[model samples]
Target: MSDATRPRLKVLAAMSGGVDSAVAAARAAEAGHDVTGVHLALSANPKSFRTGARGCCTVEDSHDARRAADVIGIPFYVWDLAERFRRDVVEDFVAEYAAGRTPNPCLRCNEKIKFAALLDKALALGFDAVCTGHYAQVVTRPDGSRELHRAADMAKDQSYVLGVLDDRQLAHAMFPLGDTETTKEEIRAEAAARGLFVAKKPDSHDICFIADGDTQGFLAKHLGTAEGDIVDEAGAKLGTHSGAYGFTIGQRKGLRLGNPAGDGTPRYVLDISPVENTVTVGPAASLDIHALTAINPRWCGTTPAAPGPYTAQLRAHGSETPVTARLDGGELHVAFDQPVRGVAPGQAVVLYDGTRVVGSATIATTQRSTPGPSGA
Candidate 1:
């Protein structure tokens, strides 16, 4: 939309102290929107400086965001959401692991914190939309309904993590970086041209909350240590582990198994049972899962009433697999055209129709066929 035709909106841009958000906020302002920058203080005790680019939410990041807002000539502020982050993302991560399921903290944060909590507060304050640096597009149909789609930059597409956003959230969401075909280097160049100091900053990686990037160690601290038995499908003990929650599906390394398979092939983590306090290890071929049942469905638009052909993404940043899925009787049933391995409970399974995000749900259970004499 052109500046003359587009309505000037009271935009609340979420500056994450990175080059992308700085550039995104600048773009929103240059588009003639009444933009104000806000950085989320997700950590209560924020670190003074980040260790390389491994994590974010440090005291130095807040300063970068402030300087960017100054260069953009927009008012800036920091919102302390530490308590909410702990209760929603961090605690949920620990609880999911304790229940013997792998969870995606980024997806949870997008669902509960960014869209739910932060968006709610923004709307309550009379903001027209919440703008972010997420590389996902929001398309509005002629019927006045909104849809979320993948970004033009496929390499940086974040639609999988954002699949949890419902129609309501999509209505008030703005992603300034989504429609761009520019590369990351181009984005940094844009930031530099705009006089943003974060132009050359490294993109944050790993779990932002985990400073050391040691997920198992963080979980052990929260869930505590407990010796558990590692067994086979037939309940034959193979080894022992400090905690069953530490291992996830398709995990091979760090298993520390004392015995190898009968055929001498390496074993993979097949299942985790918190109830039994047991971790199941089996052949790698057995990890292939044909079907899955998921709950807590969140759709971008209308809910599908019948089964449809689409693609299923089992993890963020993972490849999509062609599948047949249906939302029936308050649950999602997905049958993969090709069996996918490493799927675990508590992970979000996002469905897509081509580039458009159909919806997402939490994987509750999966059905796997055993490899028989044919080894199929």
Candidate 2:
């Protein structure tokens, strides 16, 4: 489209000092948007440099982001959102672990910080939309309603973490990376061609707050320790542990069992009871779940016209399993056609109709179809 015909927007490009964000910001500018790059300072005390791909939000990252903005010829600024991130993401993660639940901090960051806090601030500053490098598409329908869809590169699609964004947020969101048909390698190549400094920067994989990638140590430092027991299906004590919050469902390692089962079968953690301070272990069969309940559901679009079939995803990169979902009151109930394993509470359960994200909620509890053996 010509500049005369294309819609010009005052856009805020959220630069994460990564190659993807740099390329995305460049694309936004090329598309005729009056883009301004803003790197978010999420860490209270950021390190001077980043060590490998351990975490994000270091001072070095901010430098890279600023340089990218310079190359793109857009005004750059650093927004200090450390306090908000600590309150919303870090505190929530610690509390969820303390309650014997596994929470995904990335989803919370998108929901509360990036789209909510940052977007709100951007609008107040006269920006029409907050553009990011996330690999997810926002499509405008014929009726002018926006829908969030998976990126062209399925392997790199980030729609799961963005499932919490409601319709309102979707209206003011722009994903330049999602509009591309290329892969991360190609994006990095484009950045290098454009003389961006972050062209070869490593991708960050660990949680931002847990810099050392030691979730257990982080939680132990924040929430302290509570002695707990490792028991079998029959409540027969197999071992002891220092904390119940340290363990998660479907975990097989770090159990430190004093004695192996009589049948000599491998054991996996099936449940974690914070109140009882116990970790329940059993055979792999016990991990099979037929139904699950999720709390605090957030739908991206309007409520489903009717309860029906929808693919449910448990993890960000995990396979989408066929299931039926029904929302009651404020909770979501999902029934799987086949048994699903390794589902943990406090994890976000995202529902999708094909590649388009419908909504998501936090897993509260799961139900089994048939009870396993008493001592299994």
Candidate 3:
């Protein structure tokens, strides 16, 4: 579309002190949007600088974001969302782990903080849309509805984490990087060409709140010590653990089981019972799950015309398995075409039809086929 025909928008670009966001903000300005950059102060007591690529939300990160805004010649401001982040993301993470369930905080941030909280405020304050550097595409359908699709760069696609967004939230979301069929290297180069300070900044990885990647230690500090017995499926005691919440399904490491499996096979964590304070360990075959039930389903667009085939992803960066899904009694029941391993409860199971995100839900439970005499 030419500039004469293009509609000018009052855009709020969420800058995360990364090259991607810097370039995104630049692109928004280049497109003639009345863009303003905002950096989210998620960490209350941020360190002086980021340690490696483990975390963002540091003092230096905010400075970098500000410098990027200056390079882009846009108005910049920092929004303090530390308390909200603690309540919504950090505390929720601990609570989920305490309940013997795995939770993805990035997904929660997108659901609660970014789209729900930030977007609501942005729209109310007269902004037409909330732009970000998330690697996901939003397509405006011919019927004037918006559809969320995978990024052109498959390696950097982030639609899985963004599956939490509903159609209404997606309507006012802009992702400049999603439209380009380029890589992260090109984004940084663009930032360099634009004279942005974060051109050489490393991409942030790991959880933002957890400065060190010690999830077990972080949980131990918050939930405290709840001593539990680790046992096999037949209730045979294998060892003991500091807490049942410290382990996840299909985990084989850190169990410290004194005895090896009777048949000399590797043992993995099969289940975690917080109420009983027990962690169940079994052979690898026990991890194969055939069906899973997801609760509190949220569709990005609409419910399927009929129950049929769709690709379901259990984890971010996990394999997509073809499954037949149906919504019954407010729950999404998915039967995988093939047995999938490491299906964890409390994780978001996103459903996709081709590139478009159909819906998502929290995995409440999984059903596995019985192990046979010869194993799974």
User: How many steric overlaps are in each model, in order?
Assistant: 0, 0, 0
For candidate 1, give the lDDT of residue 208: 91
Task: Tell me the TM-score of model 2.
Answer: 0.96
Model 1 CA deviation exceeding 4 Å by range: 1-6, 371-376
| Cα lDDT tens digits for candidate 2, 84-193 | 99899999999999888999999999999999999999999999989899999888776777788888788889999999999999988888888567977898899999
Q: Can you tell me which runs of candidate 2 are displaced by over 4 Å? A: 1-6, 48-50, 372-376
RMSD of 3: 2.7
* Candidate 1 residue lDDT tens string, 15-82: 98999889989989998999999999999888922678977889889999999999999999999999
Q: Write the per-residue lDDT of candidate 3 for residues 1-376, one digit (tens) a residue.
A: 2111237899999998888888888998998999999999987798922668878889888999999999899999999888998899999999999998999999999998999888988999999888899888888866777788988888989999999888899878888888678877888888888898888888888888888888898899999998889988888787888899899998989989888999999999888889889988888888888988889888887766678899998888987899999989889999999988988899999999999899899999888876522221
Cα lDDT computed for each candidate against the true fold = 0.88, 0.88, 0.87
Off by over 4 Å in 3: 1-6, 371-376
TM-scores, all models, native as reference: 0.96, 0.96, 0.96
Residue 237, candidate 2: how far off, in angstroms?
Answer: 0.8
